[model samples]
Target: MPPADGPSAPPGGDEVDRIVAAWRRVAPDLDVEPLEVLSRVARLAHHLDRLRRGAFAAHELETWEFDVLAALRRAGGTHELSPGQLVVQTLVTSGTMTNRVDRLERRGLVQRRPAPDDGRSVLVRLTPAGATVVDAALADLVRAEHRMLAVLPAGERRALAALLRRVTAPFETTARG
Candidate 1:
C-alpha cells in the first residue's frame, strides 16, 4: 500500500471539489473517467521506482547495471552476449551500451572477447565474479517483486497480468511488425 499522502489517492476533499467545479464548467461534455485509470498508472510507476531503487541498492547495483546484467543472465550459462545483442535487448543506444560494457568490464564483472564467427565484432561474457554478482542481485530482485505481489491475491495478480498483456498486445504486435 502507498502512503496516505501518495499520489494514488486524491489530494483532498477540497482539491477534488475544486477539480469537479472546474471540470463541470470547462469541459462538461468531456468524459474524465479515463483520468482515474491513468492517474493510478502514474502513481504506481512512481511507487515502483522507489521499490526498485531500494531493491537494487541492496546488491550495490544501479538500475542500469541490473538491466545489463539481467540481460546477460537471461542469455544462459557463461552469460555471454554480444554488445550489439545487449543493445537490442536493453533498448539502449550503441554508445550507451558500449559505455555500460566498459564500466562492467572495469569492475571485473564482464569481459570482451573476439567474436567466434566475426572478426570485426566482440562478445561480452560475464566473468565468474560477474556471474556471482548477477545471481545474488537476481535473487534479491525476485524477493522484492514477490513482496510487492504479495499485496494482491494470487488470482487477482494473475488477472491483472492478463489484463495488462491485453492492453500491451497491440503495441508489441506493431513493434514486431
Candidate 2:
C-alpha cells in the first residue's frame, strides 16, 4: 500500500492536480492550498539533524551525552539531580539513565552521591569537569541554534515559536498526564 501521507497523483496531471479538480467540483468557493510550508519544515528538521551531529561531534560528545548533561546543567546551581529526576527530564528509561550516569561517572564528568534525606536513593551531581564541559557545550550549541534561526527575523522567530507552542500544547499536556 502507498504511504497514507504520500502525495496522490493529480487527476488531470498528478495527485495534487486531481485533488484540486475534485475540490473545484465539490466546493467551488473553497481554497485549494499548497503544502509547501509544512513539507519544508519536515525536510528542514531532517537536515538539521546532520548539522547537530557535526556540532556534537566537534565537542567529542554523543547526542545522548548532551541530552543528559544539559538536563543536569539546567537543574540550577551545583547541578545535582537524582537519576529518577534525570529520567523525567530527559525522557529516558531508568535503565538507560543508569547506563548514562555510569558512563559519565567513569569519565569523571559526574558522580553518584547518597541522597541527603533518602538512604536508598542516590543523586547524580556534575563534577567540576562535567560542569566545565557542559558550559562550553551549551555555548557552542547556542551558537549553532542561532545560525539555524538566522534565516528568520527575530519577530518572525518569536511568532513561529508561539504558533508551534499552540500547535503542540495539547500533545504536551496529554503526555504529561
Candidate 3:
C-alpha cells in the first residue's frame, strides 16, 4: 500500500528505482546515494527549464532575454544594472552580457545609458516594454511552478526545499570561494 503523504513504490517499478538497482548489481561496493538524489535533481531541472522556456516564450521572450530583463527588473526601482553587475547576476561572461545588452537594446526592451555617477561606465536599463513583458513572463512562470509544486503539501515542500538547500550549499559555497 502507498503512504498517504507521499508517492508509493510499486513492486519492482519506478525509473529511479530501476536505475539504482542496476547500479547496485553492477557496482555493489559503490555508494550511489548521491546519484539517486542528484540524478533526479538534474532531470527535474531539465523539465523545469523546458517549462520555464515555454512560459517565457508565451510572453515573446526567450529564456536568456528574460534572465537579463528579470535581473534588471529586480534591481530595485531603477531597473538598471551595469553590464558587469549583470554578468554577476546572470552568470554569463562579459562578452555574452555585452551581446545580450545589444540584442535587448535593438529590441527596444533595454537601453544602455551612461552611468550617472560613473561617467565611463554604462548601465543597462530595462525599458517599459521589457518590464511589461518580463513581468508578465514572471507571473506565468510562477503560476506554472506553483502548479507543479502543488503535488507536495506545504510542510513537505518546505522540508524538501530545506533539504535540497543543505545538499546544494556546499557547491554554492565552493563556487563563491
Highest TM-score scorer: 3
lDDT of 1 by residue, 109-147 (tens): 889999989999999998888778778878887888889
Over the stretch 1-177, how does candidate 2's per-residue lDDT look in tens digits?
Answer: 334544344434544455555666567787655433454566677877777767777878887898888888889887999998898888889999999999999999899999989999999998888888877877887889899999999999999999889978998888667
Highest-lDDT candidate: 3
Superposing all C-alpha atoms, what RMSD in Å does each candidate have to the true structure?
5.3, 6.5, 5.1
As for TM-score, the candidate ahead, 1 or 2, is 1
Candidate that beats the other on lDDT, 1 or 3, i.e. the better one: 3
Ranking by lDDT: 3, 1, 2
**Per-residue lDDT over 31-140 for candidate 3, one digit per residue giving the tens place of the 0 to 100 score:** 99887788888889998999999999898889999999999999978899999989988888999999989999999999999999999999999999999999999999
For model 1, the stretches where C-alpha displacement exceeds 4 angstroms are 1-26, 175-177
lDDT: the better of candidates 2 and 3: 3
lDDT of 1 at 170: 100
